[model samples]
Target: MSKICIVYHSGYGHTERLARAVERGAKSVEGTLVRTLSVDQVETHWSELDGADALIFGTPTYMGGVSAPFKAFLDSTGSRWASQAWKDKLAAGFTNSGSPSGDKFNTLVQLADVAAQHGMLWVSLGLLPRAPGPDGLELNRAGFFLGAGAQSPHGAPEVEAPPPQDLATGFALGARVARAAVRWKIAAGQPPTELATRA
Candidate 1:
């Protein structure tokens, strides 16, 4: 019953779809409860975030970084930082854009910085690719599996959607974060199946 909170800002509906995909993956884990919140929603009760076992951040890459709304949410986390409220919690981030190389890493790095400031343990995508052959997608490839960058044209049809592979990658990352939180709780002398390992 560990809790995984996914906080994200989706400029277009595409990112929101990705957030839901991540939520699906988190909930797939046994004994895990998943909560998905938009940045606006989290802004009102971010202190409650301190109660979650892990926080998975998501955003649509805007001009090479996070959207303005997500940045606003991050700014408000200073209060939590002042109190060290998120210390030792697990954190991960996902970013999506309309190009294959949309400076997604910058977004992830920004999220890592926030987690570090809050004293949380940050987790990378740490994904293995599902390419067809050994010479296929390298684990270090730009868009392996942990983080995703969709490649639809700026105004493509909604049905175009993110690449199935990218969506799968986001889901995997979410599950990994939740599982990591479960392990962190266990190491702290709590049962892994417990809900909300708040600091």
Candidate 2:
């Protein structure tokens, strides 16, 4: 089976929601194992990453960059990088912030940089934005996104959220990573369906 690891840090509940949305997308694929961990938890069993076929990153953008906690987690992977343990592994990232343009893309670039340092293959969200307005009632329709560059405006308890289209975007991105990983494995002479099964 193929294993995908999602590692992230959410200062508030917002980023965590994004992580969950990403996971929802990843879990939709069959035969694929999805594991989630926080930056703090990753330090205990860093080797857990070795079993992963791909790594999906998540973090809230802060001060024009990724949150410090997530950066700390990325820094902890230096040992793995030196050993080339994650080389050629599939990688992807997602970010959230209060402002629409909080330089979230910079965080994605940083994520790619980290993957590159580890010699991992990074995946992009090939899915396009949903058209015809938000999905459903449009609650949280603007919050969820995949492949980085995501933002969610502050909302009240009674206020609407990012909307459904954004969440679907996240879901598609997760599926894209799984599919891409399958292709990568096939290119590496591995079985394409080794880790895909219906839920």
Candidate 3:
């Protein structure tokens, strides 16, 4: 079975919702095992994460980058990187903020950079990079090709926001990771038993 772990830090529960969508998408695939862990739990769950086929990160954008807690989570992987524990593993990221142009790409880039530091393969969202719109040309509303990007409603509960498009975008990101992980594993001699395309 292919395993995908989603590690995330949610400041106001919005990112948590995005993470859930991602998890749901990943879990949709047959023979795929998925896990979602908050940033605070990474220390204890690091082993499980390291053993996974793919690790997808989610974090809220603060200032022009990821939140402090998520940064701490990334920093915690220093020893893991030193040993190249995640080498050859797949990596992707997602981020959320209050505004559409919150410089969220910086956070995704940082996540990808950290993954690279661990010798992991980075996965893109595989969508076009046009401006966000509810149109056929831009299925991912944030125009995020590097990773999923979400815009949450400021001062509103997560239940009331993040827009449907963002949630769907998050789901697509997770599904993409799962699909890629299975393909990679199969190519590495770990044949996936009839893996279905869930995305």
Give the CA lDDT, 0 to 100, for residue 78 in model 3.
82
Cα lDDT tens digits, model 1, 1-199, are 6888999898777888878878987887888888899988975766558789899988988988889999998998777899998898888888887777787778777888889999989887776545331234222234444354544457668545665656666677777887887787778875655465553
Worst 10 residues of 1 by lDDT: 131-140
Model 3, CA-based lDDT: 0.87
> Which ten contiguous residues of candidate 2 have the minimum total lDDT?
137-146
What TM-scores do the predictions have?
A: 0.85, 0.83, 0.88
Which residue pairs collide in model 1, if any? Answer: 1-31
lDDT of each: 0.76, 0.74, 0.87
- Tens-place lDDT digits, model 3, residues 1-199: 9999999999878899999999998988877899999999888887889789999999999999999999988888888888998999999999999888799989999998998999999999987754353444345777888999998867766455677778778887888899999898888885455674442
- The reply for model 2, stretches above 4 Å from the true place, is 129-146, 155-157, 160-162, 190-199
- What are the runs in model 1 whose C-alpha is more than 4 Å off? 129-141, 144-146, 190-199
Model 2 / residue 74 / CA error / Å: 0.8
